[model samples]
Target chain A: AQSVTQPDIHITVSEGASLELRCNYSYGATPYLFWYVQSPGQGLQLLLKYFSGDTLVQGIKGFEAEFKRSQSSFNLRKPSVHWSDAAEYFCAVGSAEGYSTLTFGKGTMLLVSP
Target chain B: EAGVTQFPSHSVIEKGQTVTLRCDPISGHDNLYWYRRVMGKEIKFLLHFVKESKQDESGMPNNRFLAERTGGTYSTLKVQPAELEDSGVYFCASSQGYGETQYFGPGTRLLVL
Candidate 1:
């Protein structure tokens, strides 16, 4: 079975500071990776997804992630974060078999301070 | 177009009581899924429905949890004799097709008191 691990349970960053969230996954084959963000009392919104081709994938809200095959990691990065960026971020991995469901990490809470 | 919508944003029920949660997927979406997130845990898949038929229900916790979709449009998840463990946020997602990106709903927060 595949699984995901997010080493950081909580991350605090000052407004306008750069941010990076770590994510690692364990899967047997090539995996489809995704990053999602959830605000308080709101549903999850897709931050980005990586299926194939480019190793670096750009997402909305000026967020990006790079897929590193060697490291088995797909970490999310932003040049600058706003207070509104504070939320819970989840990292997920899906198998190539098609029928497989997504395995997600426990999530990392990003706290952006003023 | 509206995103996936779930009924009763929050619900509080006594233990052993029966509760039903509804999910209305995005129109024209052929795939719908149910997932739950318990406190301090990752969001876990409960089941998947392709139209009106259940394609995979392996993630369902137990027989006490029942999910159904009629007319391949909306879905309902019912839990009978709910336990404290069942208290969590239930999220419903829909995809255009198999292996496609899924759009999630606001979720129904169930509190089993």
Candidate 2:
């Protein structure tokens, strides 16, 4: 079974400040990793995904994540966060071996302040 | 292109009542999936459908939950004699094919009182 852990339940960051959301996973093999963001009353939006590519993958909305195999982690990052970036972010792990079913973390709520 | 869509954005029902949720996948998508997120918990997978066939349903909680995808189009999940623990946000997702990136719907929030 694949499981993901997001240590931070809540995080606060000032506008224009760099942000990082930690994510760790336990999978038997190389897993498909993803970051999703959900704003109020909206569906989960895909941010970035790592599926056998460069360790650092870029995504929409100026988001990026690095996949470190040795650490079993895929952490999301942004150079600078905007107030609009405040939302709940989730880290998920999947695999073709598992029929592409995703196992998600508990999620990290980002609170961006001015 | 239209994204995956779910009906009855919010549902409030009695604990013993029944509720049915609907999901319309993106046109031409061959894979549809169901998931649930209990408040403060990680989202959990419920089932997977390939066309009109059930590919995997190991995550389904019990027999009270019945999901059907007729004609390989839209899908419906019916929960009968619902329990308080069944109250949660149910999400539907669709993908073009197996192992592809999935697009999610807004989700149907079911609250059982």
Clashing pairs in model 2?
none
Error of 1 at B50 (Å): 0.6
TM-score of candidate 2's A chain against the true A chain:
0.96
Candidate number with greatest lDDT: 2
Q: What is the TM-score of each candidate against the true structure?
A: 0.98, 0.98
DockQ of each: 0.72, 0.78
lDDT of each: 0.94, 0.94
Q: Candidate 1: where are CA atoms >4 Å away?
A: none
Residue B91 local lDDT, model 1: 93
TM-score of chain A of each: 0.97, 0.96
Candidate 2 has an lDDT of: 0.94
**Ten residues in sequence with the least summed lDDT for candidate 1 chain A:** A94-103
Candidate 1, residues B1-113, lDDT tens digits: the string is 99999998999999999999999999999899999999999999889999999999999999989999999999999999899999999999999978878888999999999
